[model samples]
Every structure is written in C-alpha cells, then in structure tokens.
Target: MSILATEIWENRFFNGQWAVAEKNYAVTEVATGDQLGVMGYAQPSDVEYSAQQAKVAQEKWWALSYQERAQIFENAIQVAIDHKADIIEWLIKESGSIVMKASFETDLAIQALKNAMILPSSVQGSVLPTQNGKLSLAKRLPLGVVGVISPFNFPLYLAIRAVAPALALGNAVVLKPDERTAVCSGFVIARIFELAGLPKGLLHVLPGGAEVGEALVNDPNIASIQFTGSTEVGRIIGAGAGRTLKKVSLELGGKNSLLILDDADIELASQNIAWGVFLHSGQICMTSGKILIHQSIFEKVKQRVVEKVQQLKMGNPMDPSVNIGPLINQRQCQRVEGLVQSAITAGAKLEVGGKANGVFFEPTVLSQVTQDNPIFEQEIFGPVAVLMPFATDEEAIALANMGDYGLSAGIITSNVSHGMQVAQSLKVGLLHINDQTVNDEILNPFGGFGASGNGTRIGGPANVDEFTQWQWMTIQAQAPNYPF
Candidate 1:
C-alpha cells in the first residue's frame, strides 16, 4: 500500500474459505524498508469476502453479553501466552526487534487481553440520583465495528491493545497491521481469537499496509479508528476519519524526558536510563527522549550512563545476550544518524554515537543539547538520547517541558513532594518518580496528552470505557413527581 511495504504470510484462514490474500504489502525489505518483497494486493474477492464477514459477524458479535465478550478476550490472552516462544521468533525476523523487546511487548499484549476479559463492570455507568418517578440510566454500549490501525513498533502490543478492547465491548474489528510485523503478530493474534472461540470475523486481521488500511478506515462498516504511530501520518488518518465522524483514538509520537536530581541514586538512575533509552533502539513513543540532570550529579550521572551504554551488546536480535538491535531499517538508521549529526553541527556534543555503519547504529547519546535542537523538539524513533544539565528544579521542569510532545517523563528522586510537584507540573500523560518513564502495569490506564496523541490502550476497568460509548436511557413513569 505504501510503496514496497509488503509482507508474505501464509493464508490459514482462507485455506478452505472462498477468498485468499495474494500479497501482504507493496513488497519491500523486511527490516530496512528497502524495496524487496513482491508488490501484490489481496484479491478483490478476498477483500470483499473479509468485509462481508465483518458485516455479518457484527450482528452476532454485538449481540453477546459483556461477560461472554470478555471471555473470548481472556481465552485469547491464554493462547497468546501459550505461543510466546513462537511469536518471539516471528517478532525478531519480521519486526527487527531484540528478543527482550519481543518478550516485553508480548507480555504487554497478553496483559491487555487479560484485562479486556473482565470489563462487564466497566460497562456499568451509575445513575444520577433524582427525585420522583422519572428514571435515568447511563450505560456503555459497543460500537458496531472498530477499525484498528497499528504501527510497526510494538506491533503485537499495539494491535492487541486496540483489538482486545473492541472485542471485549462486543464489537467486531477490522485490523490493519503494519506490513513488516504482520506475520508474527497478526497471525498469532488472529489464531488466539479463533482459539478463544470468538465469533469469526469479530476479530478479523487484514495483513496489509496503507492501502488495505485506507479501505477499512474509509469503509462505512467501520464505526471507529484506533491508531498508533508517527504524528505526521497519524494526523492524516485522524483527520480523514474525522470527516466521517468516526470515533478515533490515536497514540502518536513523543519526546519524553527523564530528570536526575542532585540527591538521586546514580547507579539506579544509570541502569534505568540504559533500559529506557537503548532498548528497542529507542523506537518507543514513551521512551525517554531527554536526560536532564542536576548540576551536582551531572558529571557523575554522565560517566555512569556512558559506561553502562558502552557495555550494551549490539548484535542480531535473535541472540539472547544482545541488548540492542538494528533500527527497523536502514532508512531509520539514517534518520537517527542525521539527527545526531545535526545536533553536533548545532554545537551539541555527540558523546557516544554520531555515525552509522549499516542498519545498526550504536546506542547513542548527545550531550550539551539545547532546546532549539530538532533532536529535542522532534521524536527520534531510534536509539538516540540527548543529555543536558539543570541548575535548579525550576530549570529542570522548564527543560523537561520544552518539547511539543508530552507523552511520558521520569524523575529519579525519592522525595514524595518533589515527585508530586514534577508530576503535576509536567504536561505529560504518565509520570514516574524514581523509575523509567516507560513503566506500565496491566492494571494501569495508558494514554497521552498533547501531541503524543489522544485516548489510551491498556487493560483495566477504565480501558473498557474506550471500547464502548456512554448512552443515557430515560424512562417516564406513569406518575412523575420530578419535572420531566
């Protein structure tokens, strides 16, 4: 759909069915985004058949009670967990991610699905107490068909985040997964849905790129669109969906920051920073973008961080010992390298990584970076981190909040009041005190404010609200004492 962005997946669903997929994407390199795969599209009959499946399934899918819907999600979670090893392998080959990343992302997906299984309670909305015989009731009802568009990074996790909820709400979904990671995630998740005994077509997976995505998002059958990826593309899809007045949930890009206070633990800070910055090549929206250190511990923190980063093993992701992997493709490596070079050109010091040799770039760090640097303002969806020293808490807060993207930020301080202050002051959706900003619990609700995108994907009672819309049903009694 997006030129040369294609994946080859075996069609298990259509083996005995009426239609079959001819190709996955536009045909391109698996990791580097170089054109390599065959430029093929699904047969027209396949697309039409899939849509018809969704259309027909929506009726039965929507008719299920909340617990019945949730049961399917719970079973899907079990299926995902049971197939973790196989899915991890697929993630490595298809998504260009480290095994550790695959494990975590898989875990995130399983948790989300598990959470989606217990949301009948979330669907219940309390009635506003009123006098007389007049009655007012509020409840959450499913959107008939949800169109889910997921990005390449954290493919399984993001898709599960979107799909689990839509299913839990008794809504059928048409998922358009990113081409690169389609096979491992799309195939695995779809299988989970089937094993869960979910009604067919309720969780249909369309393993194609932008063209397939455009078809689903534009279709009248799709009642909502939930997306995660770049801000530029997110805006385009979000705007287009808005024209149709479709309910949209988007988790775009972010330039998150992590601050180290003068009285913080350097050891803990450095270890956490290494995990937050280098893991996944920094290809996470919630990953720490800026490292703001207090002047007292600035040099100490820098030395420790550099030492830790240098020790990280950068190699093929299939190796269990490798801590870091290549950027999604050569193009992403180039983009991140360009940003580092630009920062150095702007007088920032490239303390660690400033150049790229191939698809792999060193887990890099840039020091003395200013607010004006593009590296600070833009989301570097690569393993690049910028570090700066702050004179005071006020300066730290100012530096941390300088970016247009406010997704998540972390502060390494044990002080409760200081932690609360920073959390309240910053404009981010999630804040972690004495921990990495990327922390997520299955019980927690995950979303962002500002440019990082709207709405959230997580497993919890609150997340069920995202899957359904609130409706107010009023009934008038025969004799009413309250004004009607």
Candidate 2:
C-alpha cells in the first residue's frame, strides 16, 4: 500500500477544507529517487487567500476564551497522537528520516503541541509599579496573524514548533511548509488541526516552492513571520521583515562545533556524536559540521569517529536497522560531495566515506581540516564530519568560535566544571555539556546567535513572547491636576 494514494496525502488545506492544486508537483523519495507522491503547488492567489482568510479569522480566534483555545490544542494533541503511525510513515518516505529519527521527531511534535497547552494559562500580564498613585499594567497579546515558514527537515516538529504556539496564543496561522515533505508537514498537519476543531480560516496550510513562500511573507495582512531554514534565505526574510517593520523570528543555519577535551572518553563521544552528525543524514540546523579535539587525545578520538561512522547503516528509512538515511534531494547530495571534495583538495584527509550514490551520501569523516578549507567555514549539511586538533583550551575555543555561525556547540569532557567553563566561553546560543550539538527540548529556548539567526529564541515560555506583543494599560485612580 502506497502512502500517497490516499485522498489526505497530497492536497492543500484552506478555510477549513482541503483542495487539490491545479498543478501537481511530484515528490521524490530521498533514498530511491522514485516518485513517492505528488503535492499540490499552491498558486500566488492561493497564498494571498490564505493570508486574507487568516486576517478575517484572527479576530474571532482571539475573542475565544483561553480555555477554549487550550481545549483546541488539547484536542489537536490527541489528533497527533492518534495519527502517529501515519505521521511517522510520511516522515520516513517524504523526509527520508530513519525509524528512530522519525519516531523521535513525531514524539517531539506531539510533545510540543501538548506543551503549548501551557500558553493559554501561563500567558499573563505584568503589573508595573507607577509613581503618584498611578496604575500601570502590561498585557501580552497575540500578534494577530502569524506566518510560519518551516523547512523540510523535521517538518512536523518545526512546523508545530511555530504553529502550536501561535494558535495557542490566540493568533491565526498561515503555514507554508517545504515542498519536499508536504504530505506530512502540510496535509497531515492541516488534518490534525481540522479534526481538533480549529475554526474555519484560522489555520491554513499551503505547500509549494519559493514563490509560495515569498507570497506568504510579502502578504501585508500577516502580522509577523516565523521561519526555519537556511541562513541565506533567513537573511532575505529578515531584511524584508525589517523593511515592512514586521516582527519576525528565525531559526537558521549552523556550522556548529563539537569540542572533545583532553580528558574526554573518546568512545562515548564518538557514539553520541555519531547521532549528531548522521541523524537525518545531517539535515538538522544544529548538526555539528566541525569537531575540535584536544591534541592530546586527537588520534584516539579520530579513530573512534571513523569506527563510529563505519557502523552507520544507510538505506531505506523504514528499516529499523538503518542509522543514516538519504539527503533531501540530489542537489544537496552534490553540494555535500562538492564541499568534501573542496576540503580534500585543500589538503584535508578523508578518513572514511566520501561517495554519493543517488541521494545517499556516505557518512564521511575528514581530519587535519584547516581554517582555509570550505568545509571549515561553509555549512555542509550532510552526513559529513570534519575533525581538527587544537593544542590548548584557548586554541580549541578560538577554532570553535571562528565562524560566521554560532547556533549550537558541544563540549565533551570528563570534568563537568571544565565543560561548563568551556560552554560559557563559546559564542553559540545553545551549548550542550558532554552532549552533541544537536540538542533540543520543548521546555527550553532553542535558537542561535550571529549569522545563525536573530537573537529571538523559540520554544518554552519564550515562544509566547515571540508570537505576541506587549500592550500597556494605565488607569488614573485620581485625576491629575494639569495646567492647560
């Protein structure tokens, strides 16, 4: 039975209903390069319509009581839970996520939706102290209509990371999911909300390419924009949002680093870091592309990394045994190949795995990578890892911070105190002590610094702040005497 043969598999949802697109875009499976499904390519008019409908629905959605909003989210969570198997199937087929990755992401998405239930009750106004017996208070209000642009990687998790919060905070959402994972991210997401009783026009899902994304972003009715994708595209959205004076939040690119201190357990670091680099074939934004190892244990760590890479099984995502799956598309596979080749030309040693077959690229490891190498600077978002040695703690920190990206960084050390110290010195927004760079929790603020993104964080209680605005209210207990 094909996953896409069903009516709910490849369609657009708008105004609380589903419709097929006039033109169908064929979706290819990353592993086999076969037609997995066909998704509707939303037209510019459709995008505009989503925005207009969202605006019309925002008022009514906002008027709902917090309990009502929370109930909807609660129902939505149940819907996600009920459709878990289908979501996982679509994730594997469309996003090329291995079993563990698909399952983890599905659970994360469900948890995010469940955690968002806190928003309705947790969102509170602040009472400010005023002088001369004046009453001042500030209320956190929804941003009206939130425009969410999500990436193909971790489609369900990333989409709901924004959508759940925006809807929970009383704002209508217009979601533009990446075309590659339209089935899971677009249609399934809409179905979940629809079944959860989200009102008509309050939630819209349009899956298309760049034109559809641009239309959604440029829509004047969209009150704010939330995006997760490459840093280059994030820059454009940031600039456009700036010109329009619209509030925006971005979770962008990362060439994150993983540092192995001299006292680290090489075997454990290798075992854990392999998951970081190879999970989803390194498609995650926080996947560590660079590794800085202390010169003392550099050789041991490098050998262990090679061994770990060798252990990864790349094949169909549905197979429980496969650890690494295919990249999202052939272009990305080629880009990873090109980056690895460029590094090799620059004198970096390819320790293991550097070949690409169809959409599947071997999990590669490179050593002696210099700062001049493209892999050292550019984000090769594939199952490729680069290892470099540093003589001292300062040198390692310098190498880790010597990049345009500062999204996430990891410090692996036996000494907890030392790891904490190193973590504090790093420039990235999120740091993991004795863990991989690719770490996320629904209850924590997740985002990056510098070229990685604007400092605005998402998730946790911060999401409410990002998707809402502060409005001040004042009352005069007594009329003030003024000379007019």
What alpha-carbon RMSD in Å does predicted model 1 have with respect to the real structure?
4.3
Report the lDDT tens digits of candidate 1 across residue range 1-484: 2111133233332211213445535433334554433322443344445666776787886676767776776677777777777777667767878887888887888878777777643636768676677678887778887878888878888888777777776677777777666665565677677667877666667666566667766777778888888888888888888888888887888888898887788898888788888878888888888888888888888899888888888877878898888777788889888888888888888778666768888888888888877677877878877888999888888988886677899988868677777777888888888888777676767777777886655445556666788889877757546876
Q: Backbone clashes in each candidate structure, one number apiece?
A: 5, 0
The top-ranked prediction according to lDDT is 2
User: Across residues 1-484, which tens digit of lDDT does each residue of candidate 2 receive?
Assistant: 3323455555434445677678777877777777865667788888888788888899998888889989998998888887788888888988999988899999999999888887898837899988867889999988988989999988989998999889988899888888788777867778888888889899988887788777777888988999999899999999888877789998899999999899999888887678778878899888888888899888888888898888778898888899888899888899899989989999999999999988899999999899888789898889998889999889988999988899999989999999998888999889899898989988899888899999999999688789889999999867888899
Listed in order, each prediction's TM-score against the native is 0.89, 0.96
Please list the residue runs of candidate 1 whose C-alpha ends up more than 4 Å from where it truly belongs after superposition: 1-18, 24-52, 65-67, 120-123, 455-459, 476-484
Reference-based TM-score, model 2: 0.96
The TM-score that candidate 1 achieves is 0.89
What CA root-mean-square deviation does each model show from the true structure?
Answer: 4.3, 1.8
